[model samples]
Target: MSAARDSKSLSGIAINNSPHVQQLQKTAPPHLGLVCITFSKEVRFRTITRTRYLQLPEEQRETALKVLYRENLQRLDLALTFCVRNSIRLYRMPSGLFPMSDLEDEIGATVLEKMSADLAKIGQRAERLGIRMVLHPDQYVVLSSDSPHVVTTSLKILDRHARTLDLLGLPRSSWSLMNIHGGKSQRADQLVGVISELPENIKSRLTLENDEHAYSASEILQVCQRAEIPLVFDAHHHICHENLDSYDHPSVAEMLYAARETWANPDWQLVHISNGEEAFGDRKHSDLITAMPNVYREVPWIEVEAKHKEEAIARIASAGFF
Candidate 1:
């Protein structure tokens, strides 16, 4: 990689209340974050299926959890180090770090507590380093499912996510959020109701995002307002769902500003940036962002949720887009 530009010339975009953000405001680039999966070959998770791990005998299963959790934590440490060296301060931690952690009974409290303590150290290091950590559970984590069983299962997944963040010692605030789209548009009202019922731990750190098909930014904004949670404005998703004739349509700018206001703290505002594929304007993220709505350029933090990950960010940096 080429030498990073002087931090003084970088945007003083702050995210989270950590002093690190304050520190970076004076010496770091704009608050651009990358989603999980590093492009560099520093460290990687050799993940396993929950089923395969659970199929083992009780004693063996417990051992597997310890081993897997330890490896993920170690890899996470190395990944954070890589981010620091590369001038990447914001990162979305993978939800798969502890596969099927919702199975607390099977894993046993002793093992779970140990894992949590270990991971908390990583979170502390991230805080100390001024990196903002975040998470986005998979699409299957839908809290608004009409089926009672699906809703119950969705809460379990959310509970697991909350427990993980808590263990990492991340602030239960917009700074360290778990963002998800409004599940199943027909149940939008039900979704808002269910969000109200969620444990404060889960609800407080949660952020609602507008998806490509089910909900437009306008619609999701209402849900976020009702639930008193922040909104993540995805430029690509907005374009796909908004039916705009061009990416620079006025509605894009309107939604961007509207979503930014939903954030409880101005510094905590985050937006998702990506490009759509050609067919049907499919939501598949392109390798590089050639252009973006002008409004997106003003957000404090933008997570590049593209297929190319760091390479896409590198392209943006190389193009002098940030």
Candidate 2:
């Protein structure tokens, strides 16, 4: 395989934050997945909301949280083992891997201490096995939110993600992407200033992505240029809504090229793919991909969003779009 295209990259990894996945399977028993539940037992991930977690009795909270954190790390370790077994190189580490991890600095420090050894083991295995870990935080984590409280919370959440990568020993670079969307319509200056002031660990791996609403490829490309951060152009999101005419827009390829240019490494440049479940413009993701933009042919790490998770990836691999 050429350096430009990894055969492993050809087999896109799976993530389960999509609403459709949540709708299909309500969480199963605790014996099945400890505190969190998964769409499939094989792909264990998902977390209780902060509200529910806080509702737990004070005496039971720490013990409950300890179980959640420990099992999450175990699931992650198993995820790496699964990757090595399948020869897959790219995996999206679950955003809520540690439930309420971003609650506060003291809480984060205490939790990190408990799992430092597990983190090191997982990091070493990922390094030894050649896997690339990336993250797309919860949609509610918006740096562009108009509210100062929201902005501060987003900072804490993002800081937790960066700290996780640091613990895992992933490079402080886009190669270990902490991808998030420009989900709000706040003034560019405010958003850019917040990004500019981020710690080097967070800013170095930070990536901005276009969304189906609010921010478009053109809008985010400009932000990426200004922030000097990589842009993860989601082809389906771009097709659903953009200033440019849907798929046939000649500029789509140019946008992909420009977004690709934002990344420091060609091999680490990322893109996202998902098709509508019902109609072309429907925001809901389909269980399997029916088509892919030809323009993404040369892009590396095309993260697929589908309800079926890895099954969709297997179908795409056999379908021969690449």
**Top candidate, metric lDDT:** 1
Residues 144-220, model 1: lDDT tens digits = 87788878888888888888888889988878899888898878789999999989789989999998888889899
Task: Give the backbone clash total of model 2.
Answer: 0
Local distance difference test, each candidate: 0.76, 0.71
Question: Candidate 1: which stretches are off by over 4 Å?
Answer: 1-29, 108-110
Query: Candidate 2 has which clashing residue pairs, if any?
Result: none
Report the error of model 2 at residue 273, Å. Answer: 0.3
For model 2, what is the C-alpha lDDT against the true structure? 0.71
User: Candidate 1 at 260: error in angstroms?
Assistant: 1.5
Instruction: Tell me the tens digit of each residue's lDDT in model 2 across 12-64.
Output: 32223333222112132100001122236785865677787788886766777
